[model samples]
Target: MTRSAPQFLCDPVLETVQVEHGFGTRGAVAPGGTLRPNQVHGNAVARFEGGSGVDPLEADALLSRIPTQSVAVVTADCVPVLVASADGGCVAAVHAGWRGLACGVIPAAIAALSEWGFTDLRAAIGPHARACCYEVDTPVLEALEGPFGPALAEAVRPTRPGHAGLDLQRLALEALSRGGIRSDHRGSAAAMCTVCHPELFDSFRRQGDQAGRMIHWVRPIRDA
Candidate 1:
């Protein structure tokens, strides 16, 4: 197996604490075997205790209090969300495609963390296909609109006759807000569109199945 340097984008808020969180680029590799769930575009979240190796849980989100265990989600066009407790006791990674978002993945993750006794969480939204390049049809808009309402519908601006550009980051932020994460508690979106910045990130919508996946992970730094 070929390993690459740990070239990743870090959120300033997450970096301030003992939490080690990042959004990896195409070739960057994580230190240990990253715990990635088999994302099925649904709103399932898997929780982990201190352990090693991969379990390949069938879910869209992974939550853990184990500092030594890193949880991650791989994405090409979907949004990758990494969240940590205010004190770095717990962390979570979510894979939110439009369908997963529609099914309540963000809120589900928040609830899982809350159940783990975490509060005042901080989150980072990683790179993905932004509204600038994520054009979608009526069903996608409808899936979001019924649950998220008008604000979400407004984010989906009409690009062509029947297609519209959907801002996944905006929708994710809304979901976070609805989950009780204040504006200050969340980091800004990476703001780089994977579809637009092919040299930096990958985009399934742009490159189809040939597009490589990027890993976005977060873990608490274990005490020595």
Candidate 2:
């Protein structure tokens, strides 16, 4: 009941309140003029309130309170996070990779939404590179230590010499928890992993820079 298309996904948490959203698969295109950020893999957030100006699209997260105007983020191997208020009055689309996670992009997006006076939030984390195929070295683990701290080991698995497989979804969920989104409000992870299911997803690790991105989107809707 949570999918809008055969390839696109939705979450019951957001669907319960009827927030318009879709987690893209491989070939879907985002609508024209959809608000998105430049995605620096940092914690910057951009806000939209039905404005005509397009300033500050340089953020990694895009939040909106306006109905109909879509907000989106693109991803291949990175996490695409969609968040909305309980009443569907506002929504956010975040692009989170490990660097963005270490920088607190998820938490930053939630904080920005809370600052806008909508704290009762719900979120859905889309597919990304899972631990099965996503390996990392010492530098990657070291960078993650600051954000994940003692909980870091919970999402890592030793693979090779000075390297390990990393689960980005777990860390993303942790970031969501730290951002104040209740445990139940953060929906379950998508079953597909970008690397493992190449037929359904685009994997940056598998296909390198030539991989096509998926456009994950969320649109604000009026509360009933």
Q: What lDDT does the true structure give each of the candidates?
A: 0.85, 0.86
State residue 144's C-alpha deviation in candidate 2, in Å.
0.8
lDDT of 2 by residue, 104-156 (tens): 88888888888999888899998888878899999999999988998899999
lDDT for model 1: 0.85
On lDDT, the candidate that comes out on top is 2
Model 1 weakest 10-residue run by lDDT: 48-57
TM-score of each: 0.93, 0.93
Provide the lowest-lDDT 10-residue window in model 2: 1-10
lDDT of 1 by residue, 83-112 (tens): 998888789999999998899999999998
Clashing pairs in 1: none
Question: Largest TM-score belongs to which candidate?
Answer: 2
lDDT of 2 at 17: 73
